[model samples]
Target chain A: MNSEILNIPLNDYKTTVESLKNEGFEMMMDLTVVDWFRKKEPRFEIVVQFLSTSHNKRKTLKTFVNDEDLSISSITDIYPSANFYEREAFDMFGIIFENHPDLTRILMPDDWVGHPLRKNYGSGRIPVQFKNAPKVD
Target chain B: MKDYKVKKSKLSNFKNKLDFWATNSEEGGWNISSTDEGSQKMLENENEEQIKIQTGTEVLDDFVIDEETSDDERMIVNMGPQHPSTHGVLRLQAELEGEVVRRVKPIIGYLHTGMEKTGEELNYFQGPTNTTRMDYLSPLFNELVFSLTTEKLIGIEVPERAKTIRILMTELNRISSHLVALATGGMDIGALSMMIFGFRERELILNFFEKTTGLRMNHNFIRPGGVAADLPDGWQKDVQEILKVIPEKLQDYDDMLLDNPIWKGRLQNVGILTTEECFAYGITGPSLRASGYSWDLRKSQPYSGIEKFDFEIPVLNEGDVFARWRVKVLEIFESLKIVEQSMHNMPKGPYKIQDKKITPPPRKRLDESMEALIHHFKIYTEGFKVPEGDAYVAIESPRGELGCYIVSDGSSKPYRMHVRGPSFCNLQALPVIMTDSPIADAVAAIASLDPVIGDVDR
Candidate 1:
């Protein structure tokens, strides 16, 4: 229940993950991004959840990413489970996973325009089209 | 890893040789250059088929590969965006060489309604309504995890009665969810009776849920501070009926499927997933337990005072479709035990926390007291503010580790809310389980994994 939270630098994210992997963290529970548009200096924060099954512990690894540089090295090499998650983060927040295999949008259509989860992207902006329904302005 | 040498199709006479593009999202449909050559080079340098099954000991005997089939007859097969067996809009593209599955890619997102985007817009109070839709089978678990995260951020505790109520409801929900998994899994493998029996038993639990939560699915009953309402009068009788009937029905399932040769043939030694593979893929719940790993979040973490009850985490070493099915069957018994204990030890107190900011005053009090009326108005309109910090709370849902991570900016609404859906993570293992197996086994593999697309595409 007592999860250790570590805020690692962007450069040290992979190294920290590797060390954690060596330190009995066999399972990567979850990976997601929180877009802090104007509130923080860095526009996005990548949050990774790791579980050490042998040690019976959980760890949360967080790293910040600037708006200008939206890419981070994918941890799919270490935790293969992160494949879909990284793609989801890419689809939602537009945070490119640098070495992700098939880094296409996993949750959105391929032709969709903007990241939906980003603060700048407004919800209910796109109108739905029905065959015989009347169109709304 | 075995290499699949695919021969070119002998249709050169045709003007255009039609290549099967599994998904429109896959190459040349929407036309996004998704292939990363640098990553490809790195993976190739490391090893082909980079999915590492890191068993400290020798791999299990069931993971035996058959004699190499001729790749000359290889073809791409797309199963389900509409197929009933895929369990809700999950599309899987498998490379098949003469009925043997070579590789699989699960193309999700058909059910993506941008719920997470909608979560950013809803406040902490309204959060459960959004989350309950994800993993629709176990709606209470989603609500519970979301509420727990919100409560953690707010730094408040519900009463003992509320905790006990939550445990009771969630355990029953687990039984219902597992019943659906068993039902659908049975239906996939040609056991029509099981589908009927599972639903018949599950209807009892859904009826109980409706009596308590007012709706069958997407209850949104379990709130941040506590449950929305107290257990309805004579709820004990409803639970007692479930406890009485489900065990009898489960015995019937065992008799029907356990020793049946055809059932065993279809499930056993098919879709083998080693513990190492499960760990690598982050597959928890029965799938991970089926692979001989005993990692249940409820027993380990003990949220919402569930540690008060006594139950066992059923584990099997087979790591095949049969083991996964059997593990779920056994888990229902354990969940039943927890539910029975919770029923006996049901506490008598408030359903929600006593804090005025978190819980609104009763309707009678609203007319009597002016302050109570004001509190209700403010709470409903503005909502209670959580402290400026983030917390992630995970619980052992029927599926797996259902976690909710919430970031608070000292506001009523969550700054960012993300759900770590176990189905989504478990779907990553489809390729590992389905590869080198027969095409028929792929259906069983998917059914055993039980990737509910609502959770995956959420």
Candidate 2:
């Protein structure tokens, strides 16, 4: 029932996932991207959670990714269920998943411009259409 | 119980065969051979198909629009985004060949609300309101996860009474959620009576929710340190009323759907996802339990006094729609048991935490003391700050493992707040389960997943 959290090297992230899968991390519970835009070295952190069904244990793995090199090797090879989540990360944070067969925008319109999750994205400027207002499109 | 054991052993044997086949065959994942010699030939053909996929001759990617799709053999169709049986705004693109589904690609994002980004904008005190709407059906779980994660960040503990009350409310909500699953899933497969019966039972639970939390849905009762309010007068009787009626109604639902020939035909063998498939896709909750892997966060990673409760984790090895239905119906009995235990052990104490820094002063204190008024004003406006740390707290929602990952930079607002929604992740298994099955079974498959689009797109 104990949940363990570890910080693995970015280069070893793929290997860690593979080893964890082999070690009976039967399913991935979740994968999230965190933006620490003010930090000096790493701007983004990819937090991955894997679950052992038999043991009822959870292990969370975190790896750092900077804005400059936003790419991280995909774990879809080990966990096929990570496909949608990786795509969601790509859509929200623009953190690319390398070796992902179909890495495109998900959870967002395909034509939408810029990643909306980065800290710098403007939160208030978008105009809200009222009932009486004419459609912008 | 005997039947469950037999099926579970058979499933383990099936897995061993697959493991044996995996090592012997050159083909890797997702290419399962048949039971006998059919598998030998499939191994060879699967290798060729892998080569084609590598060379771009066969674009096996599910999401893309394939140009190589021949017009003569198969045709493509979209099931929903607007269709009724879809349960929500989920679009499934199915490639069909004479009523057989080749692949079903679920197109999501129609309900996207940018909730994660909005979480960062809202301070910790307002986190529950934002998260509660993620899974509109199981809103309390969303609040629970957000609250649990925030508590982890701040290192605060709820009172014993608060924990028991949380356990009580959430267990009731679980039964309510499972009822909706039965209703919508049964309705999808053409069981109109089951839908009515399911909703009837759900109404009773929702009524109790309305009485306790002041709202039927999206009750932001749970907060970081404790719940927002205490149980209403005679609330225990309300829970006891639900406990009285649900079991009898469940019996009615079982008699109607469990042994019906048409119900069995539609859901028994339809949407079979084996244990290995669940592992590969990271699917959990009822779907995983139906697949024979008994991993529920309540049982495994106990939180909010769940460890003290005595309830069995019902599991089935069939990994089919019927198995999921059966598991959910059985789980309601266990939830009822939890409610009964909680009622017997109910305590009398303050519901919210007593700390002045965390919880606002009572309204009476505001008129009596200027310091109390100032404290309340500061707490509401600025919100209490959490130390710099990152934490992920996952709880078993009705659908699956719903997790909240929060990164705080010692600010009232979160540095980042991302939800690992079960609906979004469980939806990935759709293509795997729906492929090669009949087109009709796809409806049952999706309904069995019990995915709420709000949770998927949040």
Candidate 3:
């Protein structure tokens, strides 16, 4: 019942994850990126949701990462459930998962270039083949 | 460009050699030089090949059509991309050693439809249309979770009657969704009769839903601020009829499957999920409850006037596939009780919030007042904006703790929306469940988890 929401900053993501692992937060429900294209500097926000059965509590950790090299510590070592979700985040938002064992695409094909979930991604473009049909004048 | 032209000449020479071989073969005897139209057509085909070679810029698309099966010690077995027992388009590449599974990597997204990204592009009012498509079996649950989160962020006070009606519809949806799992799970385990019986009762429930929401599967009845419209006339009567029949049918299902030795043997102790492991995977709903953790969102944190309903959160001590099945069957009865109570205590008032900002003004008033017309147009076109904040709402859906986390930046569309789908969490236990079990049991284990690929891939 003693639950509190902690707003940890982006730099402390690794340390916070390590500490939570020590505290028996064993499950990583999801890790997703929210693209705030309208923002400056860090245009992408990473959200990690965790649950601790011993404490019967769930907490969401949010952090901002720069668009230049959007990477974060992969939590696969701590929570095996994150294996698919992190791959999905990578496939959709183009956020890289540092040290992920198999960081290949989960939702899209291996040859897909641009992430489709990014706000600026062009719509109606062919996904798998990436073939651009000639535009009519 | 000069190098490409040289390669094109060599490619033409190769094509000429292939044509010569084809013509010389007994099965493919054709005249190389003849005046017949068929021979002329063959010449024209060769001319087109010459044109392709003359272009000299065509890139030979090098694609690996079929990957050469590796001779490494790893054994590759495809669980399903199309197999019926997979529940949906879920393909798992499991690395096995003899009879033991070494590692399993699930390949999803065959059912992906860009639902989350689509939600961001659409207006807030159109959000339900996208959310309902994620978990098609439990559309009302998806819409309700999204609507509640958006409503909480927007600070709109939905009418008491609207909240009651929402609860009523969602509880019925919970039963309907569980029935789908039960029927399909039963069929997956070789009990074909159970599927027929389960669907028989489920059709009655879907009939009630169609009466109220005007749709059988994807009922977008629950919307932001409240329900889409008031319940149709005699809605209570129709719901009461279902309550009267469903409990008896559920009893018959229990009698048929609960004590059958074959069904019990296949599920009672198979795919056992320990309490510690269930918590570690953040498992919820029947799967969590079957492991002896009595956590139901309806009792822990009631929303949409669910606290007023009289129902029990069904739980079991056995953390196996059978236990999960039992928990769901018991929940059907519990839902029926809630539906009967809601029907008896049905409230009378407007079904949606009266605020012109959220709900449009009445159609009659639109003709009379210019202000009403403008408000209606604005509400429909632009949609109401939510405050810049985030809220996570969890509901005890038939599938488990179905939660929606919404982040709004004071815009008509959600800045970010994520679903804590029970199927996705429950499916995490599959690798552990199938590690030592026979390969056939893997299919039953997956079906018992009742994963909808739409939810998983999204």
Please give, for residues B296-411, the per-residue lDDT of candidate 3 as tens digits. 87887678888887778877988778888888888888888888888888788888887767887877998799998888888888988889977777777777778787888888
Interface RMSD, candidate 1?
7.9
Model number with the top TM-score: 1
Recovery fraction of native interface contacts for candidate 1:
0.62
Residues A12-106, candidate 1: write the lDDT tens digits. 99999999999999999999898888889888999999998898999999999766878899888888888888989998989988867567777
Candidate 1: regions farther than 4 A off: A132-137, B1-71
TM-score of 1: 0.90
lDDT of each: 0.85, 0.83, 0.75
lDDT, residue B12, model 3:
72
Candidate 3 error regions (>4 Å): A1-4, A21-27, A52-57, A127-137, B1-74, B96-102
Question: Please, what are the lDDT tens digits per residue for candidate 2 over residues B312-376?
Answer: 99999888888998999999999999999999998778888898878998889999999999999
Q: lDDT (0-100) at residue B209 of candidate 3?
A: 83
Native-referenced TM-scores of chain A, all candidate models: 0.95, 0.90, 0.82
Which has the higher lDDT value, candidate number 1 or candidate number 3? 1
lDDT by residue for model 3 over A12-99, one digit each (tens)?
A: 9888988987898766656777888876458888887776656667777888886678888787666656766777788889888887
Candidate 1, after superposition: displacement of residue B387 in Å?
1.0
- The CA lDDT at B285 in model 3 is 79
Best by DockQ: 3
What is candidate 2's CAPRI-style docking category based on DockQ? Answer: acceptable
